[model samples]
Target: MRILLTGAGGQLGRTLIDRLPTEWDIHPFTSGELNITHYPSVKHRFLNLRPDVVINAAAYTAVDKAESEPEHAIAVNAEGPALLAEAANQTGARLIHVSTDYVFDGNKSTPWVEGDTPSPINVYGLSKFAGEVRLINTLPDALIVRSSWVFSEYGQNFVRTMLDIGLQRRQLSVIEDQIGNPTYAGDLADFLIFLAQKPQVKGVLHFAGNETISWFGFAQAIFQAATAICPAYASMQLTPISSEQWPSPAKRPRNSVLCSLRLAELGFPSSDWRARLSEVVPQLLAANVLKKAN
Candidate 1:
């Protein structure tokens, strides 16, 4: 299959570039190379390439910053996917777009299912939800995967941030009230590739790590994993605090755990997040060590 991937410079995009099936021919584009916000550029590129599948991994992910720059966020997150769907429709290509769990209000006690109505509380979430609506309206067959708390070896994410901060500061504060599943970008990339080959999968789907934890709990796990590789992280202190204690420009959902019932039914099993973290933390610490030496 010929697959065209957007956001190749991002965490998920980077992972997908490395993990995509070797048999498939990939035309990867970073935002700098092909800005999704510019429909003429995206459409022209797609028409020429004529890919069998188009995976949109690009997004405006600054949750708090979106409050101040809603227009920019909408242009990238909402308008971009819609334009991609239009191009894919003209080219008769399947589209797999990545969304977020933030679409929900985060008030539910149980994990969110695909059928749940979205009630986004923040500009970032609202923009993502809008993107989903736009894509579905343009192409009903488009596959939309909604995930949460993504982290990996590449890109700016919570895991890397905590590791860097924990090494530099002896003490830190993390919000304990917010809870959600943390996804491994590598695993998500693998699944997206699996879906690309399977034409049967359509509509909204949920995929996330097996376990759900708060930011504070995730920090503890990160430190535990890092300390084994680098002793300096062992002395770091992580203080658990409430969301109100650390106010942000945008309001976040208190609970945004996604239930991957549909994903499990499709035969893709969920992996333990802590186990995945252990595998990644060591690599991250090793990279840090090498960076300091140079």
Candidate 2:
């Protein structure tokens, strides 16, 4: 099968490219290579390649910066997906789009199901939600996978930031109110590939790490895991703060844990986030140590 993977430079994109089944013919493109916001560029490639599957991992992900750049955000996050959906429709390719938990307002105490009403609190979330609407309108059969708190060794994320901060500062403060699952990109990638084979799967589905925890709790776990590799991370004093104390231009949801009911029904194995974290934290810590030595 011919698969065209966008956002090749990103954490999830890289993971998908690296871990996708070897038999599939994968054509991976970074944002620099395939500008999804530009229709002509996106069109030419889709027409030429005519891939059996188009996995759009590309996105404009700067949450705070998006507040000031609404047009740019919409262009990439909203309009880009529309373009891909249209192209995929024309090309007869199945499009799997990656989205975020931010689509819903953090008002609900329970994990968000696919049917929940989306009330995006910030420009970034609104843009992603808009992208979902556009994709569904364009292709009702399109598979939209919504996930949250994604982290991996490949890119800038909470896990890497916490590990770096712990090494530098004697004290660290993390927001405790914002709650969600901390999904490993590698695991999500694996799930995506699994879904690709299941032609029956369509519409929006939520896939995240099994456990839900606040940012503060996640930080505590990061420190706990990394301490085993580098003792320097242990010296940092961790403090929990409310979202109000750590205000940003982009307002975040207080709680956006996603329910994996659909995922479980499909026979996807539930993953223990802590166990997955254990596997990657050592690699991340070791990289930090090597960087320090360099």
Candidate 3:
């Protein structure tokens, strides 16, 4: 099948590219090659490629910067999906648009269902929520995957950040107040490919790690695991501090856990996040993030 994959350079996009079989005619386009924020340029690609599937992984993902750059965020996150939706509608291409758990405020103790009413607390969340709304509004048949704390061995993410700090300093402080699941981008990429093959997987579905924990706990686990997995990283101490101790320009959800009984119902296997994390840390270390070179 001919497929058009946007944001071919980001962490998630890179993982998707890695998972795709070389035999498939996949047109991976970075922003310089095709910027989704520009409607005309986006339409041109769709018209030219005439893909059977369009996987949108492009996004303005800077949570703090999004506060000052709401227009750019909306243009890229909201309007970008709408433009793609229009293109998909015009060419009869199925869209697999990625979304976020931030669409709903982190208030629910239980996992968020597909039908939950979104109440975004931050500008990034608000913009992403609008993107989901716009995508559904434009193409009702499009598949929207809401996920959280996406990380991979290859990308700039929390896992790499922790590995870097642990390598640099003997001691490190991480936030303990915030809670969410950390999904490995590789697992999510594989699931997206699986979902694309399942005709019943259309519409709003969620994919996340099996367990949820606070950022502090997550960091502590990472430090402990890194030590076991990468002996070079074993001696460092990871400290947990409250959110009030560490302030940020934007506030995130106190809870960002997303429930996916819906995912099992859709025939996707649930993954234990710890096992996934265990698998990814070694890869990250091998990639030299543990050395903190760049």
Candidate 4:
């Protein structure tokens, strides 16, 4: 199968490239190589490659910064997908897009399901939801996989941030009110590949970590895993605080946990983030050690 992948520099995109079957012909493009929002560029690339499947991992992911830069966010998150969907429809290519769980307003106590209508509260969420709507409207058969709190050793994420801060600081403050699943990008990448092979599965699907946790709780788990690899992290102290205590430009949903029952029914269950955490922390610390040695 010939696959066209966007956001090759990102955590999920990098993971997907590493994990995808080597036998298949893959064309990976970073934002610099192929700007999805540019109409002529997208059209030219799609017509040239004629890929069987197009996986879109490109997105404007700065949740807080999006408040001040709504235009930029919309351009990348909303317009980019629409352009990609248009190209995919024109070229008869299947599009698999990655989205966030922040689309909901966090009012619902239960986990957010595929059928639930999205009422985004912030600029970032609004942009992402718009992207989803545009993609579906342009290409009705496209697959949209929504995940949450993604982290991996490769990217700038909670796990790496916590490890970096824990190395220097003795005490750390984390938001405890917000709750959601922490998805490992590597696992999400694997699942995306699994979905890619199955063309019949089109529409919105939620795939996240099996465990529901707050940022504070996630930090605790990160440190717990980190302490085994780097003993310095054992001395770090974490304090949980409400969202209001740490003021930000953008308002976030208190509960954005996704329901993966539908995905589980499809034979691919949600991954255990704790296991992934255990694996990634060591890789991060080992890389740090190597960096120091170099």
Candidate 5:
């Protein structure tokens, strides 16, 4: 089957390129290759490729900046998927659009279920939610996977950021209020491949990492894991701070955690995020983000 992939440059998109089966035909489109926000470009590309499926990994993920640039966020995140869906509908292709936990308000005491009603608290969340709304209207069968805290060897993410600051500064402070699952890009790719093959698995799904923790708590794990990987991390000092203490334009989810019971039942078993982190940290470090001999 022919597969058309957008946002071929993100952390998840990079991993998806590697994990997708070599047998299938893949036509990758970068930002320069395809501007999804523009309908003419998206329609032209889709008509040219006439792919069997379109996996849209492209998104404007600037959370803090979204508060100020809500229009750009909506155009890229919300409107982009709608345009992709239009192409997919015309080409009679399946659509796999990636979404985020930011769609939720993060007030739930428990992890969010697939059926939970979304109430995004910030511009980013609202934009993503708008995308979802348009997708369902455009194509009822489109697969939408709602994930959280996605990190990988490539791209700018929390894991790489923490590793950088953890090594560069003796003292680093992280927000203690936020909580969510940390999913590896490769892990997410594996599950996506399964859904791609099994077209029946359409609609909203969650593929969050196996474990759940607060931002500060997750930092402690990162440093602890770093120490395990590179013993030198024992010398690092990491501090915890409240979100109010470090003000940002956007209001992040205090309880961004999501429940994956539905995902497990659907055959996508959970992965040990800590164990996965240990495995990938080396690559991230070697990728030069850490920049020290491990």
Candidate 6:
């Protein structure tokens, strides 16, 4: 299979590259190499590569920073996907785009399903929702998988942030009101690769981790996992606080948990994030130790 993957430097992209079949022909490009917002460049690459599948992992994911830089966020998260969808349509290639759970306003008490209408409360969420809309309009058959709270050993994420701060600070306050699934990039990558081969699966699908918890709860879990791997994290104290207590530039959904009912029907259930977390914490600690040694 010929695959063209964008956002090669990102956590999900890196995981995808690592997990994808070694026998397949893969063309990976970082944002610096191929700017998806630029139509001519995207078209040129699509024409040259003519990949059977195009996995678009590129996105502007800075939720808080997006309030001040809506244009930049829209260009990458919204326009980029549209351009990629157009190119994929022209080349007759299947486009599998990764999206976020933030697309929902978190107003629903129940899990947000694919059929639910998105009413993004923040600029980042709005941009991602716009991307989903444009991609659908451009290529009706394109698959848009929406996940949440993604983290991995490679990139800057909530897990890494907590671990880094835990090592330095004795106490940390986290938001308790907001609830969502914490997806592992490796698991999301595996699902994406599986979907790439299943051409029949198209449109918006929610593929997040099976477990759902608030930021504060997630922080506790992170610390728990870290303490087992690194004894230094045992001293860290985590306090649960409301969203209003933790001031941020962007407003997040209080209930952005996604429902993966469709995914379950497909026979591939949602990933166990706690299991992945156990594996990831050790890798992160080992890397940190190695970094210090250097």
Which has the greatest lDDT?
4
Segments of candidate 1 deviating more than 4 angstroms: none
Against the true structure, what is each candidate's TM-score? 0.98, 0.98, 0.95, 0.98, 0.95, 0.98
Name the lDDT value of residue 293 in candidate 1: 95
Residue lDDT tens for model 4, 12-110: 999999999999999999999999999999999999999999999999999999999999999999999999999999999999999999999999999
Q: What is the lDDT of candidate 2?
A: 0.91
**Model 6 alpha-carbon miss at residue 139, Å:** 0.6
lDDT of 5 at 89: 93
List RMSD in Å for every model shown. 0.9, 1.0, 1.8, 0.9, 1.9, 0.8
Candidate 4 positional error at 273, Å: 0.6
- Ten-residue segment with the worst summed lDDT in candidate 3? 285-294
Q: Which residue runs of candidate 4 sit more than 4 Å off their true CA positions?
A: none
Q: Of the candidates numbered 1 and 3, which has the greater TM-score value?
A: 1
Q: Compared with the true structure, what per-residue lDDT tens digits does model 1 show for residues 1-294?
A: 999999999999999999987778999999999999898999888989999999999999999999999999999999999999999999999999999999999999898999999999999999999999999999999999998999999999999999889767899999999999999998889889989988989999998989989999999999999889878888998899999999999999999899976876788977568888999999888898899999
Q: On residues 114-182, what C-alpha lDDT tens digit does candidate 2 reach at each position? A: 889899999999999999999999999999999999998889999889888777778988999899998
Model 2 spans > 4 angstroms off = none
- Assess each prediction's global lDDT (C-alpha) against the native: 0.92, 0.91, 0.86, 0.94, 0.87, 0.92
TM-score of the candidate numbered 6? Answer: 0.98
Ten contiguous residues minimizing lDDT sum, candidate 6: 260-269
